[model samples]
Target: MWLPNKNEKKKSIASIANDFIGDGEAIFCDSSTTCMHLVPYLIKKQNLIIITNGLHIATSLSERSDAKIYICGGHIYNSSGSVLGSSASEFISNFRADIAFISCEGISKNGIYMSNDEQAQIKEKIITQARETILLCDSSKVNKESYYKLCGYNNIDTIITDKKPEKNSFLVNTDIELLYPVE
Candidate 1:
């Protein structure tokens, strides 16, 4: 299967974003390039409080957007411009959000997984507290396995991808709602 280019993968983010963000919902946006793409969709919302560890997500929005933002407090992972560590996880857990938008390094029978355990812990905390969870990943990540499990397919309410999996793929058999770009 041919992997989608960066732009193809990015186009799907908007479609997924529109599905997740309601006017006044509180959301936890993960520190993934996929989640960062939500910035555009949020520009017109009102009474939104975007809680995130992704510095880019928090910083990218224009002050004119009217969305209130909170940066997760913890050790900053400079390379990725994300906040992590125990402190961050604890802080994020204190609030129960309406939804969480996350991504992982891989997806398989075991669960969706990410490379960093600290981020994984934080994502896990958010999932347990969120009313619903939306996972954002391109098709290339399907069937791949990563070091740390973020959450299981059972935990996901929806998944948006840029590629279509075969009939026998794990995603096809799941109850999770699948959203793909209109093309």
Candidate 2:
């Protein structure tokens, strides 16, 4: 079997996510490099209501689709170009999305995790408010652990990654639907 490289993997993950999205749907996208890759695919959709904390995601989506980009107001993390804080979490709670696309620093037997506590708080809120939660974690982040645990594997509706995890991977033990590129 052939496996994609880093950049190819990210695009593959983004492509899988695009399959779940459709015209005129509302979605919540977190500020992760994986989610950033999703911007180009989003541009092809019509009347998409994209609510995001990613400064770049919002900017890229705005250039083509003007009306529906909702950027949350909060403290912007310069390193990652993400807006995260109490304000951001509060803002996210106001809208109900058909899906919440998110990524995290790591995933392990315990649960999903984020290095930043603020991001974790917002993600927890995102999981509850959205109809479905799609976690976009690359192969590298799988089987790893981070500081703040976001939620258990059961909390996620589906997981899209560049490759299928090893047979013993904790991800495979869960009931969550796992998706990856077949080629």
Candidate 3:
């Protein structure tokens, strides 16, 4: 029951993401609100190549002359400002990214999960094209279950969150590196 305040958790996520990202990296970012917090940090990187399905994320970084933004073309979800479908997936396959940043609705011993099947599929494809996949999750979503399984902990190289999971929680049994805001 370690539910965290939304704004506080978002602040934590932003701090942690800033530390993990570096300059001149090719990145894949999913269309999740949590990932949106990464926009300001990404703008600071030099020669950053970002490929994303999040329209809002692309637009936010669009003004950064230091970065290159590529938005995937596919079915658009007006509510989430996300594009996902076969076309988007195919577009993603053309590039090999240094890292993929994704978010999930829930995390459990079984695997990471998403509420939307299309988003889950898109995340799956992103994972395949990146050398490393990082999941951005808040404490509130831990231990919760969702409708579609995106992948297992094995697929994620690291997880950045607002708080570290409980010792007895399923995450402790996995090898994924867990990061949280420190100052």
Candidate 4:
């Protein structure tokens, strides 16, 4: 499992969410704190609903009267600070989101990667139910592989990062739009 440098990770996630999401649309995001930060900015309208499993995120958004927050309940991984289980998967499967914003521990030339099987399963459901799936990751995660494969590069609609890869990098062939943060 690859752990990205904390600072770069947030910039990468923010750039990705800002580039892909549009105004007034619902988005499903991961429980990662870095990914959650994108919510306040990406959501342009007061009516935008945020779906997530992160308690911190739910609590923060609860104070925002403009947004409606839905919590996905299930088994909790205390170490990872995230939730995953059959119930969470079922809830995600029923949700039809305009975009599902996700964060992974690593990525390879092949595709998005995860360190846990249960998390991967939940992500799979989120991807299938949403119209578009965007990944928020830093460049340090590039070319790294993990135990569970979430999807290939082609499966990702867009990737947001702090830096751009080489022109011939593996992601180029997959045609996943790469967005870098504005300096």
Deviation (Å) of 49 in candidate 3: 0.2
Per-residue alpha-carbon lDDT of candidate 3 for residues 1-183, written as tens digits (9 for 90 to 100): 111235768767877877767888899999888888787688778999999999888888886546888999999986788999999999999999999999999988899999899999899999999999999999898888888989988799998889867779877777888888664
**Candidate 2 residue spans exceeding 4 A from truth:** 1-6
lDDT of each: 0.80, 0.87, 0.86, 0.75
Clashing residue pairs in candidate 1 (N, C-alpha, C atoms within 3 angstroms): none
Instruction: Give a tens-digit lDDT track for model 4, residues 42-159.
Output: 4455577778876666666676537777879898888555788999888877678998888887888777898888888888888888889888887888899998998887677888
TM-score per prediction, in order, is 0.91, 0.93, 0.93, 0.87
lDDT of 2: 0.87
Off by over 4 Å in 1: 1-6
Instruction: For residues 67-128, write the lDDT of model 2, one tens digit per residue.
Output: 39998999998767789899998999899999999999998889998888988888888888
Better of 3 and 4 by TM-score: 3
How much does candidate 1 score in TM-score? 0.91
State candidate 2's TM-score: 0.93
Q: What would the per-residue lDDT of candidate 1 be over residues 7-124, giving only the tens digit for each residue?
A: 6576676566676688999988888877767777877788898888887788776454788888888988867877998998888878888988888899986789888898888889
